[model samples]
Target chain A: MSTTSTTAPSRTSRTSRPRRRLARFGSTGFIAALPFLAPALVAYLVFVVAPALESVRLSFFEWSGFQGAPQVFVGLQNYVRIFTHDPVFWTALSNTVIWVILSLVIPVGLGLVMALALNRKIFGRNLFRSVFYIPGVLAPIAIANMWRWMYNPNYGIGVNLAQLFNLPWLADVQWLGDKNLALYSIFAAFVWQIAGTNMVLFLAGLQGVSPDHVEAAKLDGANRWQVFRNVVMPSLRPTTVVVVVLTIINSIKVFDLIVGMTGGGPAQQTQVLALWSFQQSFNNHEYGSGNAIATVLLVITLIIVVPYMVWTAKQEKNS
Target chain B: MTVTAIPTAAAPVANPSPKRKPRPLSRGRDWVRVGLWVALLFSVLIWAVPLIFMVFTSLKSEADIFGTPAFVPPWAPEWGNYVEALDRGHLLTAGGNSLIVAIIKVPVGLFISAAAAFALSRIRFKRQRLLMGVIALGAMVPIQVAIAPLFQVINGLNLLSTNLGLILPYIAFGLPYQTFILYGFFRQIPEEIDESARIDGAGNWRLFLTIILPLAKPALAALFILDFVATWNEYSIALALLQSQDSWTIPLALQGFQSQFTSSYGPLNAFTIMSVFPVLIVYLMFQRYFVEGAFAGAVKG
Candidate 1:
């Protein structure tokens, strides 16, 4: 937190002047770093990188994950099955895209608004921040329980509100159980959990918007909204970039929430790609198809994140 | 303790608001304060009320749950629901397994990541950027992609359904984030310290062990608390690797409870309320870092 007050901490390394000193011992820089780096390197490669590569390879073959199963080479069949035949595949794919889109808008938007409002030197704001953030940290089981109660067909908020408002149909509406409303309902839960994260990020970003700058702008006859638009938003680009990237990644990688809450149920209505892939492999025993779905998810993430990381890394380095 | 602490550092009296010379308060300012309070209260409704409702329902009997309104607290609160859920859910066994995994994984993972971060930031060497990129990429790749292959690898090693199976991959996945955070902290420490220590004939190992680590305590503490929560709550890999119910973590066991809880809402809320206490306590303890450490990951690009 102390270091964060100065500037973005990640930028500090590259921006620091690279000072190479003549080794007192010998030309043994890599040799010296080896001991420090080897264990992590070996573990990461064996467990993370190699597995990812293996997933790509697994996608092209027909292999049940069961031991002693025949591993037959099926070129493009898994991918083709997902692309052309599986109606659920399209639903899962679109659901993923929709999840990503909704996530980027709702939580991030709410977070920015909360940050702007609570950025003041107000009393009790910290407690309020904790309230918003607690759900995000709570176990998935707890969150699922709360949201399920809200959306319960029998005794949920929908039912109670319907009763109070004299709207009979709302009570019948299955919030988590319905096909049409389920994905968005789960996203509402996501907003409840995630908005706090974005708020915290933007609050940290707002710390960088020097009060002096705002004061100077005020003296020069800039109004509040103008000052915010002109001074605050521009300086918040770095935080925004991070916020957006994290949002998209979280949306794409969203699995546990869907699994815990709905299990992609009510006749497989809320199945996003991540959950769909898990179902295909583990539940359905279509290992090749499952791996294919996984590969699709991996590519989507990389295509989005890699260039952004490179671009942002460059931006942080230069700025 | 208020505005003066941080603002005073850079405030040079050019600012309009001055506590030094008291002036007449403006009418507009009082209205703004009222507006801020309204907004804050509105945010509480959006955020805390559902959580409050969760607590309310957890205390209710089965009759009270369906008979009473959603928001109303029951007249007679019972702790028996919690006892029942705890007994039926097998939460103690699951919690113990989670604790074993997290306690081992968090420290072991942090140490390995710290060593790697030290070299990446401190040691000037070829292939630094390549290694850094590889680790950075590891953080973003979903665990789903690795689950199939990882299950095979764990199976091949005959480590499946064991704590060792869970700990190994958890460490691997946890390394990137911890290393990246520590690198940022370690990089900010002046290299002149490294040069001077080297001049005194201290090896790189000694320098890391004694000097750099002590200075990077804040980052280490923050990451330790954060990593513990992640390790405890992790589910995907655990689902793929853990075959037996005996070895299940909190999340897995909770999922098992979920099927039974679907039929009965009372015990479900009770179980959820009980299960979340550990995460809540830990979060509250390190919450300042919990809120602010989010931005630390932002610049990791």
Candidate 2:
């Protein structure tokens, strides 16, 4: 490579001395970058990128995850089974959609309201901010476990509250054990864990809103609701975009909480796409179908995320 | 029409330019402030309830846990619950495993990512944007999609149930965001510093080690705390890879402990509290950096 570079410099010298120097600089820069890039590149390719691509390839084959097992190339049969015949796949997909909607609506709405409220120069402002954000930092496993016991029928806070108020009908609601209420029950816990993150993000965005504009709108005889809707909401669009996209991504990746709280139980009612994939691949050992579900999740995620990411990169470049 | 007419009649009285204060307006504002305070208090209680309950339950004896009203504070704060958890729940060993993973992975992962970020941001290469784009895209790819094949790869390499198994993937998965964040910081450093260092006959390696890293210390610290918390709390990869009880991280151990001691709420809460305490401390100590790091990628994206 050095020999080639030396010979090329001689050929390029006829063009211009500065041009030849610039070419040398570029080449040297590339060479210097190679060693620095190697470690992360190699690990990312082998562990992250390669495995992702391999999942796509594995989705086309049938394998049961046994030692000495042969992989059978089955074409699009796995996809066909998931889309056309499987009931659980449909259930998981629909539940994932519900999870996405719940995440998008409840958390984002609550966060926006809280951000608006906390945007005021209230007493204990920082204390309230920290208190709300504490749950966001705790492990989902720990949060799920804590909430799981909180939903316990016999001695849980939920039932106890119902009984304390003489609400006999609510006492035996069976938060996690009822198939009808299980998914929403887990979602309530999830919202408790995640709403704070959205709130903080919105709070940051709210802080960025120009006080001058808000005052100007109020001076123009705008009511409080009108001021918030016209001025504050528009200013928070970027944060809303971020919160919505992140919530969607997080909703799709919901696994640990479900594993901890319900184990996709109460008759597989709360099964999500990611958890179903785990069950299929690891528990059932049906690698082909599992990979197919994973592929579907990846495709769905990228369809929403890739364009946004590219746009963000372009915005960063322009800035 | 009367409503509009009344407001117009009162407009002059309410619209003082610079001299007089509006008593009704101040009274209304005070009410809103009081309402906001009430809402803020409610939000705090909602967020703190589970944590408060966890602490209270952890301190309760078994009889107290089963017998007392759920809202009542533990009559006797059983410090022995923590001892029982440590002795029987495997919390100590699992915590050590988590600490080891975080210790080994965070610094090493930060170095590799920072080096790559330096290359992408500081070094003038032709395909630097493309490389950065690839890494950015890689950040969005969920680990769930790669779990099956990654499991096979780790198992094939005979690294399953080992610290290396968790560390390798943790670093790999952590690199993209770390690189992106460090790239932002690295780009903020003036190129003239590098030029002067080069003029002093310092090589690229020496310049990075001596000048660039020290300058990037804040970013490094932020990523350190963020990555440490994330690695310590990681569950999916650890669950899929670590099979043995002895090799389990805190999350895995907690799951196993929960299942085994399904009815032992006191010890379970103790285990939960112990596992989350380190992260809580780090977060409280570095609150500003923690929030900044969390928002860096999202706001930038």
Candidate 3:
């Protein structure tokens, strides 16, 4: 190892191990952060950053996917094919959009209402919070299996419970069978698992609402709804951002639950980009087209994620 | 394995949550209070029904499943379902595989995350916020975008279908969230400790090991349990990486196990019930920290 820096002789004469001065290169000083940064930086670059970059590259190239088959660069052909020829792409894109839109509505709608309901100093608040949140801790596959069993056509709980309760109309409704209803049915199960998450976040936000502000509003001729609207809602904007961003991102990448539930079935009406990306590559061996869908998914995510990160960076600077 | 976005908004800065009590109702006005209670219970019942059905169904015989109504509990508890699940599903083996993956991934992941966090926090460097922003964005990026290429990379490394292959990517994916959490934590530790330690001739490594890490114990503990649960429940990377059934983690194995017992959901439900215990035990024991972890992990897609 040689100290190639021209000024190293002066620094080295001051101390045997002039660590900070000796390690300086390219207008930077401090060597301490390097050892600590190396493992994580190297691993992340190789495994995550490099592969993620490859996914974009793979989108532009076609390969036969055989033993040592050479990949041929085919610039926008994969994207053009997906846009022009693939109807499933439209269904998946629409389904994913619906999934993202409803995720902001149903589950989190239930979440907001529940959070407001539970924000009081009620008895059993902890119990109720745990009840709603426990489903989230279970694996998505487990949740899928649980919901699938309940949706069974003949002996499902929907049928049996309808029978026991003497409701004839509810017994024959196919939850996961019909094409139009399958995506929504999966969303229902998704709500069962996710509503609690939104609730907890809202609850955190609610707790942060200064009690003094609520009291001052109460003192000035405000009702409960008025105080909530004026005082509580404004303070909760940050938490709501976290909750909404979390929902959109999670909704977009949802694959395991869909995979376990329908496998994009019933004539492939329920395919989302995440599962489509996986199936196109692994199942159909169309690596090029799969990467194209994945890149679309990546761009969709970046649009949302980038702004949120910028906001957090701003927050960090201030904090 | 724990995933989340940058949580500057809800890092739980140890706030003292002061509850606001509702005005006490007098006499006939009690209907308002009563109505609130009714709404609460009704909503709870709706939420609890599916879980209640799972518990009830797990304890019934195959004959009783069709014989009885869906809501009823078993007249006599049937432990046989659990036995068949444990005995035949080779679930114990899958359980071991899951545990092994968690055991390896959690500590290794935590070390890198904490070290990276330490560098980002304590060590002076330019582009710290840029690096921090990159990590925060990485934490939020959907893992699906990295899937196909990650598979190719693993194949190239000759580690396809191995637990190491599964966990290496798992660790890489885990770093962003864990580092983000620990970075928030490490920033909160006072600077005086670092100042005095350096005067005592302590180097960065010694200061980190002896002083800073000890002060960050609570954060580390919270991260520890959260990371464990996340690793234990992770599905996607395992799906893309762990192809062989022999190396399948719990979630992957559950999907495989379900196909075998499609006719008899008895063993399948039993296995699902059994699988919940480890997660349930840890969750219940550390319920307080989990709320934080859950909030912290909310951004995980």
Q: Which candidate tops lDDT?
A: 2
lDDT of 1: 0.81
Better of 1 and 3 by lDDT: 1
- DockQ scores of the candidates: 0.53, 0.38, 0.42
DockQ-based class of model 2: acceptable
Residue B58 lDDT (model 2): 96
For residues A98-201, could you state the per-residue lDDT of candidate 1 as single tens digits? 99998998999999988887776566666777887777787655576688777878888887788779999988887887789898898888899889878877
Off by over 4 Å in 1: A1-22, A316-319, B1-25, B292-301
Per prediction, fnat is 0.60, 0.63, 0.53
Task: Give model 2's DockQ, 2 decimals.
Answer: 0.38
Q: Model 2, which residues run further than 4 Å from truth? A: A1-29, A317-319, B1-25, B190-192, B195-202, B288-301
A1-319 per-residue lDDT for model 2 (tens digits): 8999798878665434433443444434678789889999999999999999999999999999775799999999999999998888988999999999889999889877777776655566667777777788889999999999999898887777886898887878899999989999999989888887888778767756789999999999999899989998898888888788778878889998999999998889989999999889999999999999999999988998889978887887798
Over B6-64, each residue of candidate 2 has an lDDT whose tens digit, in order, gives: 23222233433645555775888878788879978987887888888889999999999
Show pairs that collide, candidate 3: none
Model 1 pairs whose backbones collide: none
- The worst-scoring run of ten residues by lDDT in candidate 1 chain B lies at B1-10
Candidate 3 reference-contact recovery: 0.53
Q: CAPRI verdict on model 1?
A: medium
Steric collisions counted per model: 0, 0, 0
Interface RMSD of each: 2.5, 3.7, 3.8
